[model samples]
Target: MRKKRRQRTILWCAIAAAIIIALLWTEQIALLYVLATLGLTILMLIVAFADLEGAKRSGQATDD
Candidate 1:
């Protein structure tokens, strides 16, 4: 589970970095920064939720 979580985290981080770079190079749109910020915030929320779910599952396994 941990190994999977680590892989997911790395994947998300790489995706976020790639999106940020792409946004920077694409155009000079005023909302580019805002779009990047929103994208990052959503990615972080997803990663955090996955971590919480993993913890809950691990805890339940130990309890049983």
Candidate 2:
């Protein structure tokens, strides 16, 4: 489970980086849209990481 979570986190980070790169490679309206999408993706990634950490903490507490 931890390995799976780590893989997913890396995947999301790569996706976010790709979005930012695409946004940088574009121009005008498309760039704006991509940037917005990238921002949302980053936000979601942060939320996911936070949730994962919280779950891990809870799991540890239960184990103890």
Candidate 3:
């Protein structure tokens, strides 16, 4: 599960970066920055929760 999660994380992050670059290449809209920021924030949240849950389930956390 953790390996799958890691793969998905990398895939989604790459996808997000591609989209941002595509948008930048096609247009110089200021909104693109906002969209990129939101995308990055979402990716960060996914990574954070994934690691936390994995650690907890594996009893790797201090409180576990």
Candidate 4:
């Protein structure tokens, strides 16, 4: 499950990088605000997933 979360995060980051690259290649300066919003959203998701994984680990440890 933790591996799944990490894979998801990596997938999202790769997708974002591709999108940013495409946008920059196309010279779409007007859409930078949109990109910024997307970047922040991805960042938040990463942090959330990390926290969840950490909590799971701690929970499991306590269960033992």
Candidate 5:
């Protein structure tokens, strides 16, 4: 279901953030790349969730 997918997305994002922080703590320059990638991914997820919520609202309105 959509809820499950959303939860998984959030979980993965958290995991990614944790990994990036760990790498950063170790003074790894590679963490910069990971941070950039994760930032873009989080942004995309936000957009997708916004769109999904809008669609769900419209669908519910139509059903009434």
Candidate 6:
């Protein structure tokens, strides 16, 4: 359930980031705001495909 939530959050973030980027590019938004959001978008893309379950597997001593 938690993993699914994380995936959903990432998807929503990507969509929101795209919209924000579009608005920032077309509108006269502040440069700092654009850069901050772009940084967030890059961060979202970087960790979008990470596997939380896989990380747990490597740190555990038991399969069940």
**Candidate 6 clashes between residue pairs 3 or more apart in a chain or in different chains:** none
Tens digits of lDDT, candidate 1, 13-59: 99978876776788655667688688799999998778787777877
lDDT of 5 by residue, 1-64 (tens): 9999999999999997887788789888776887788889999999877878777787784553
Candidate 4: tens digits of C-alpha lDDT, residues 1-64: 9999999999999988898889889999679778698879999999877778777787784553
Choose the strongest candidate by TM-score.
4
Q: Local distance difference test, per candidate?
A: 0.81, 0.80, 0.83, 0.85, 0.84, 0.84
User: Candidate 2: which stretches are off by over 4 Å?
Assistant: 28-64
Off by over 4 Å in 4: 37-64
lDDT of 2 at 22: 72
In angstroms, the error of model 3 at 51 is 16
Residue 50 CA displacement from its true place in model 2, Å:
10
Instruction: Give the C-alpha miss distance for residue 21 in model 2, angstroms.
Output: 0.2
lDDT of 3 by residue, 1-64 (tens): 9999999999999997888788889896687978868879999999877767666679854652
User: Which one is best on lDDT?
Assistant: 4
TM-score on alpha carbons, each prediction:
0.49, 0.45, 0.51, 0.54, 0.47, 0.43
User: Candidate 2 local accuracy as lDDT?
Assistant: 0.80
The residue pairs that clash in candidate 4, if any, are none
Tens-digit lDDT track of model 6 for 1-64:
9999999999999997887788778885786487778889998987987887898889899866
Clashes within 3 Å, all models in order:
0, 0, 0, 0, 0, 0
Q: Order the candidates by TM-score, highest first.
A: 4, 3, 1, 5, 2, 6
Off by over 4 Å in 5: 31-64
RMSD of 4: 6.1
